[model samples]
Structures are given as C-alpha cells and as structure tokens.
Target: MKIVILGGLGNLGSQLAQTLERDHELSVFDRVDFDVLDENALLNILKDIRPDILINCVAYNAVDNCEDKKLYETALALNCELPARLAQLALQFNFLLIHYSTDYVFNGLETKKEFSENDTPNPINKYGESKFLGEREILKQAENGLKYYLIRTSKLFGPQGGSPQAKPSFFDIMFKLSQDNKELTVVNEELSCFTYTPDLAAATARLISSKAVYGIYHLINEGAVTWYEGALELFQLLKQKVAVRPIRSEDLTRPARRPKFSVLQNNKVKKLRPYQEALREYLNNL
Candidate 1:
C-alpha cells in the first residue's frame, strides 16, 4: 500500500510513518518541508502519488489557547477544514481516509457510563467543539461514499515529535517540572485514558491490514485516570522522589472547560494494553 501521512513529523504521524514504512510505500509531509494546508501543493502531491491511504495527523490542540477567537479560527481550519478537504479527496481519489478525533468531544457528564463510539458527541469546550466539528465533516463525507476510519483517542504521550509547536506530553512536562521544582502540582480531575503513540500506530496498522469494518473506533490504552493520578504513576515508574501535590480543576483558571470524565470505551475493537505498560516501555527507552 502507498500511504501518505500529513503532518508526518508530528507525534502520532511520526510513529505511524515509522510503523508502516517497512510494510508499505510511505510518503511523509511535514510543515518544515511543505505547508500541508497549501491546497495546490497537497493536491499536486496527491495527484502524482495517488496514495492508497491518506492519513491526517494534523490538529490544533492548544486547548486553552483555542478559547481566543483568533486561535479558534486556526483550530477550526486545521481541525475541521483540513479533514473535510481530505475526506473530499479520499472520495475523489478512491483511497482510505484515516483521521484521528478526540475524547474531548464528550460532555464528561456521564461519569458512570463510559462513552462508546455509538454515543453522540456534545463538546463543552472550544477545543472539543472544533474536534467534534472535524468528526462531523468526515461523517458527512462518509455519507457521500467516502471510505474512512474515524479513530477517537485521548491523552496521547510518548516520544516527542519534530513539530516545533508540538507541546510535550503531560508526563514529560510533569517530569521536567519535578526536576527543577521541589514540589509539583497536577490536577486531580478531568479523568481520561492515556494513549501511547507507538501503540496507537501499531493498532492503526492492524486495523487497516485486517480490513476491519469501521465507522467510528476508539483505540486508546486501557484504564482511566485523572491527571494527578497519572502523574503519581509516572513518578513512581521513574522512581523519582518528588512531592506531587493534588490540585482541583477549579483551582486554576483556564480558558477551556474540561470534561470531568471523558473516558472513551473501546467496545468496537480489541482493547489496547494498559497505559502503565506503555508508559514503562516509554520510560525504559528514554
């Protein structure tokens, strides 16, 4: 299979390219080499390559910053418009479209019930709204005979990507803070599962290779945890003796409203290994 990965230098995209390069003809595009949003360049590349699969890993994920009107526009353009455009191309070129969505799409109100792929999205924050709109755009294309797999996952962490704007994962940030600061505070709220990029990339390959029936799927690492709990586990794994203070979500003023419990349930496919296992592997590698 000939695969083209947009935003290929970013965290998830980098892992996906690495995972698939040996098995498939892989073409990767990063912002450094080419502006992925440049319609003309992208169209020409697609025309020349006519890839069997086009994977979009670009997203505007500055959650709090997205509350600013200007950033929100950028977010919508990247998160929604870009995917919409790719979905159109997927239909026209007859290729499989693989786009990633987020767990933030849920309201987080259904704490007792985990969110399944079948659940309707009701995003509560600007960032979540933008991602949900992206999902809607792809769904519209699917209605128009677009073959696609909408994978919704959350709390991605692992090796850093080449994107300058790519922020380090929560684990990295917390670890860094621990190094410099005597005390570290992490939010003990907003529960969600963590995803390892390599694990996700591997699962994506299996899903595609198996020719699995897909509509919307959740490919997240198993288990749910609050940011504070996650931080504790992370510190424990590193065997770092740092004081981790628990903080409430309301204690800090943020631009975006986060879901209290947006744990995604993967009832559609095989469950991923627990995040603890993935996190250990990541730490060992580093």
Candidate 2:
C-alpha cells in the first residue's frame, strides 16, 4: 500500500514511517516540507501523492506554549482544523485515514476507572481541547464507509525524529541532569502511560493488517506511573546514581495545566499484548 504520513519526520511519525516502509510504499511529509496550516497546499501535495493511506500525525505538541491565544489558534489549525480538511479529502478520494490523538482529552478527575473511548471529554488545557476537536471532526466527517483508525497515545519517546532545538524529553532532560550529577525534581502527582514510539508503531501495524475494526482505539504501552518513577527507571537503566526528588504539580511553574491522572487503559489493546510489556521491551532496546 502507498502510505503518506504527515509529520513524517517527527518522533512518532518518523518511527512509524520507518517501520511501515518495510511492507508498504511510504512518503513522509513534515512541517518543513508540508505545513498543515496551508490547506490548499496540503491538498495539492496529497493529490500529487495520492496515497492509499493518509496518516495525519503532525501536531502542535507544545503543551505549555499553546496557552497563548495565537499559539492556541495555531495549535488548533495543526491539530483540528487541517485534520478535518484532510479527512474530507480522504472521503472524496476514497483513502483510509489514520489519525493520532492524545489521552489528554479527559480531565484527571475520574477516581476509579480507566479512560475508555466512551468517556466524556473535559480537556483541562488548550492542547487537550485541540486534540478533542480533531477527534470530533474525524467522527463527524468520515465517509465512504471509511476505516478511520484514531490512535490515542501518550508521553511518546523515541531516539530519532526527536524534538528539534535540543528540547529535551522528560527522559532526555533527566538523563542529561543525571549525567551532570545534578539532582532532578519530577512530579510524583500527575500520572499517565509512557509510550515508546517503536512499540506504538508495531501495534498500529498489527491493527492495520488484522481487522477492519474502525472508530477510536487507545494504543499505549502498558503500565501507569508518575513522572518521578519514570525518571528513576531511566537512571536505573543507565546505571547512573543521580539524586532524584519527587514533588507535586504545584511544585513547578508552567503555562499549561496537566492532567492529574490521564493513564490510558489498554484493556482493549491488551487483547493483543499489554503495553507495559511492550514498554519494558522498548527500554531494553535502548
């Protein structure tokens, strides 16, 4: 199958492109090459490419910065607006549309149960609201009896196609601080799943190959832990001794609000294999 992945050069998009390339003809379009903000240009590019699958992976992931109205507007364009337009094109052209979403759509107020597709979304920040808008657009506009596999994931990490400008990941910064023997403080309060890019790619490939089960699906690696635990694990993996401190979210100052417990339940995804097991495997690869 000919596949076109938007944000193909991004962390998760690049990883997915590389993995999918072995079995399918692939073309990746990143922000530098094809900006989603330019809808006409995007449609032109898509027409030229005419891929069987158009994967929308580009997103404005700057959680904190998106709080600015201008930034939030741009985020909405990248996350929701363009995706809706692209979905319309997919319907017109009869191509499968695979879009990525976030686990942030839900506020962390649910005390007992894990978040599922059916839960009501109450985003706490602009980022989450934008993502939810994208999901809503897809559901509203999908056509051709199309197969729209909307994969909702979280805290994605990978080696290549990482954030440019040396903007360190939670793990990246922690590793750097540990290397310098600097004590690191992480949030022990907020909770969610850590998804490795390659693991997510593999699971997505499996889903694409198997059933035509469409609609929304939560695809995250197993286990829910706080940022503090994730930092400790990284240090332990590196065989480095770094003093790590755990604190609450209120301990830090940030522009955007974070979900308190946005851990995704893989009960449906676990029918394949728990993402936790996949996460351990991915860590071992590093």
Candidate 3:
C-alpha cells in the first residue's frame, strides 16, 4: 500500500510515516513542502500520488492561540474546508482517507465514565470547535462513497520530530523544568491519557489494516493520569529532582478553556492491543 502523510514532519506524522515505510511505500508532506491552505498544491499532490491511503496529520493545534485568531477563518480553512475538499478527491479516486481528530470534542463533564465513540461532542473552546468542525466536514464527505477514518487521540508526545534540535514535548518541558530545579506546577483537576507517538503510530497501522471499522475511534495510551501526576511519573522515570506541585485549572489564565477531564476511552482501539502493555513498552523505551 502507498501512503502519504500530511504534516509528515510533526511528531505523530513522522513516526507513523517511518513505521509504515518499512511495510508500505510511504511519502510524507510537511508544511515546508505543501501547505494545507494551498488548494492547488493539495489537489496536484493528490492527483500525482494517487495514494491508497491519505493520512492528514495537519492541524492548527495551538489551543489558546485559536481564541485570538479568526477562529473559523484560520482554523476552519485547514481543519474543515481543505479536508472536506480532500475527502471529496479521495472519494473520486476511491482512496482511503484517515483523518485525525481530538478528545477535546467533549466538554469533560462526564468525569466518571471514559468518553466513547457513542458520546456526543460538545467542544468548549475554539480549538475543539475547529477540530469538531473538521470531523463533521470529513464525515459528511465520507458519507458519499468516501472511505475514511477519524482517529481521535489526546496528549501526543514523541521522539525528535522533524525539528533539527528535536526539542522535548510537553512532558519533556516538565522534565526540563524539573531538571533545572524550577518550580513545576501542573493542573491536577484536568485529566487525560498521555499518548506516546510511537504507540499511536503502531495502533494506526492496525486501524488502517482493519479498515473494517469506520467512523470516529478513540486512540490513546493506557492509564489515564492528571497533568500533575503525569509530570511526577515522568520525573520519577528520568530520576530528575524537580518539585512538582499540583494546582487547579482555574489557577492559570488562558485564552481558551480546555476540557476539565477529556480522558478518551480506547476500548474501541484496545481490541487491537492491550494498551497497558503498550504503555509500559513505550515508557520503557523512553
């Protein structure tokens, strides 16, 4: 199978591309090569490659920045419009389009229960709203003879991505803060699964192979933890001496409001593998 990954230089895209490259013919496109907002370039790439699978990893992922930007115009263009158009092209060519979504679609009100595919989306911020809009557009296009998959993941981190320096992810940020003896404060009130990029890529391979199940699927590592707890664990693993303090979400003033508890239920994807085992393996590698 031939696969093309948009935003291929990003953490998840790069990992997925390399992982699949061993088994399948893989071509990756990053912002430097192709712009999602550039419709002509996108169309040309789609036509030239005519890939069997199109994995769209491109996204305007800055959570708080979305609040200040022209929410719909900036984010919707890439998130909703371009993907909708791409989905149409995929349908025309009888190609499979795998689009990535987010767990922020939920409002985090349902704390006791893990969010499932059956749950309704109620995004609380512009970022989440834009992502949900993209999902809607792609699903609508898929409805008309387009084969597609919307894999929703949360808290993605991975090895040196496309960056020359290969800086750390959020977890790495916490790790560095601890290493520097800086005071680290994380929001304990909020909870989520800190998914590793390698794990997500492996599961994505299985998902594309299964291709049997379609629509929205939640994919995350096992063992959900709060931001503070996650930092503490990572610090523990690194043997770093950073004091991690817990705080409430309200303590931080941000442009956008994140879901208080956006723990994605991976039972749908867990059938592919035992997530606990996968999580342990990833952490061990780290």
Candidate 4:
C-alpha cells in the first residue's frame, strides 16, 4: 500500500513513518517540504500518487499559544480545514483517511469512570475546540461516504522530531528541567494518560492493517496520572533525585483551561502495555 503521511517529520508522524515503512510504500511531507494548506498542490499530489491511505499529522498544538486570537485562525486552518479537505479528497480518491485527536476534547471533570469514545466532546480551551471541530469536520465528510479513523490519544512522550517547530514531549520537558533545577514544580491537577509514540505508532499500524470499523478510537498508554505524578515517575526512572513539587492548575498562569481528568479509555482495540513499561524502555534507549 502506498501511504502518504503529512507532517511526517514531527514526533508522532516520524514514529508512524518508521513503524509503517517496513510493510508499506511510504511518502512523507512536512512543513519544511511544502505548505500543506496548498490545495492545488495537495490535489495534484493526491492525483499523482493515488495513495492507498492518507494520514494527516499536521496540527497547531501550542495549547497556551492557541488562546491568542491572532493565532486562532491558524489553529482552525491546520486543525479543522486541512483535515476536512483531506477527508474530502479521500472520498474522491477512494482511500482511507487516518487522523489523530487529543484527550483535551473532553471537559475533564473529576470522574471515576474513564472517558469512552462515545462521550460527546466539550472542549474547555481554544486548542481543544479546534481539535474537536476538526473531528467533526472529518465526520461530516464521513457522512458523505468518507472512510476515516479518528484516533484520540494524550500526553505524548518520546524522541524529538525533525521539524524546527516541534516541541519536546511532556516527559522530555520534565527531564530537561530536572538537569537545571533541583526543585521542579508540576501541576497536580489535570490528570490524564501519557502516550508513548512508538506504542501509539504500533497500535495505529495494527488498526490500519486490520481495517477496523472506521469511526473514533481511543489509543493511549495504559495509565492515568497527573503532571506531577508523571514527573515523579520520570525522575525515578532516570535515578535523578530532583525535588518535584506539586502545583494546582489554577495556580499556573496559563491562557488555556485544562481538563481536570481527561483519561481516555481504549475499548475498541487491543490495549497497549502500561506507560511505566514504555517509559522504562524509552529511558533505557535514551
């Protein structure tokens, strides 16, 4: 199968490219290669390549920055418009469209039950709003005979990607901070799952290969934790004795409102291993 991956040089995209290349013919494009919003160019590529699958990984995911109204349009463009266009093309080209979403789409209120895929999104921030709308855009295309897989994951942590704009993962940020400061502060609120890119890539490959029912799926590492807990685990793994302190979400001066408990429950597919296992491997490799 010929698979075309947009934003292929970024963190998750790069992992997907690495995981999928072994079994499929792959073509990857990132911001450095061309403007992904160029419809004419994209259509031409679609026409020429006639890929079996089209995967879109591009997103304006600077959560706090997305609150700026000046950047909101860019967020809408990348998160909503682009994927909708790709879904349209997928319908025309008779190819499967694979897109990723986030756990932030939920309200994140405290709950004993994990969030299943059936729950309607009530995003609390501009970034989540954009992503939620993006999911709806693709589903709108789905209503018009588009085959798609919208997978939602959270708190990604792994190797850095090739793009200049690519930000380090949450765990990576914590690791870096530990080097400079003995005492690090992380939010104890906003408890959510952390996804390992390699694990997510593997699960995605399985989903694609199986051609499972096309709708929404939650793919994430198998644990729910807060930023403070995650930071503690990361330090414990690296044998770093950094003094980590807990802070509330309200205490932090951020532009976006975070969900208090946005843990995704993966009910549709085979579950991945625990985040601790994945994180251990990631640290060992590093």
| Model 1 residue pairs with clashes | none
What residue pairs clash in candidate 3, if any at all?
A: none
User: Candidate 4 deviates by what RMSD?
Assistant: 0.9
3 or 4, greater by lDDT? 4
RMSD after CA superposition, every candidate: 0.9, 2.2, 2.3, 0.9
Candidate 4 per-residue lDDT, tens place, 141-217, comes to 88888889999999998888888877898888888887888799899988889999999999999988898999999
Model 4: residues with Cα > 4 Å off, grouped in runs: 110-112
Pick the winner on TM-score between candidates 3 and 4: 4
Please report the TM-score between candidate 1 and the true structure.
Answer: 0.98
Local accuracy of candidate 2 as per-residue lDDT tens digits, 105-189:
8888756478887677889999999999998889887544655888888887756574362234577667667776668888997
Q: What is the lDDT of residue 134 in candidate 2?
A: 90
How much lDDT does each candidate structure score? 0.93, 0.80, 0.79, 0.92
| Model 3 spans with C-alpha error above 4 angstroms | 163-167, 271-286
What does candidate 3 score on TM? 0.92
Flag regions of model 1 displaced more than 4 Å.
Answer: none
Best by lDDT: 1
Backbone clashes in model 4, listed as residue pairs: none
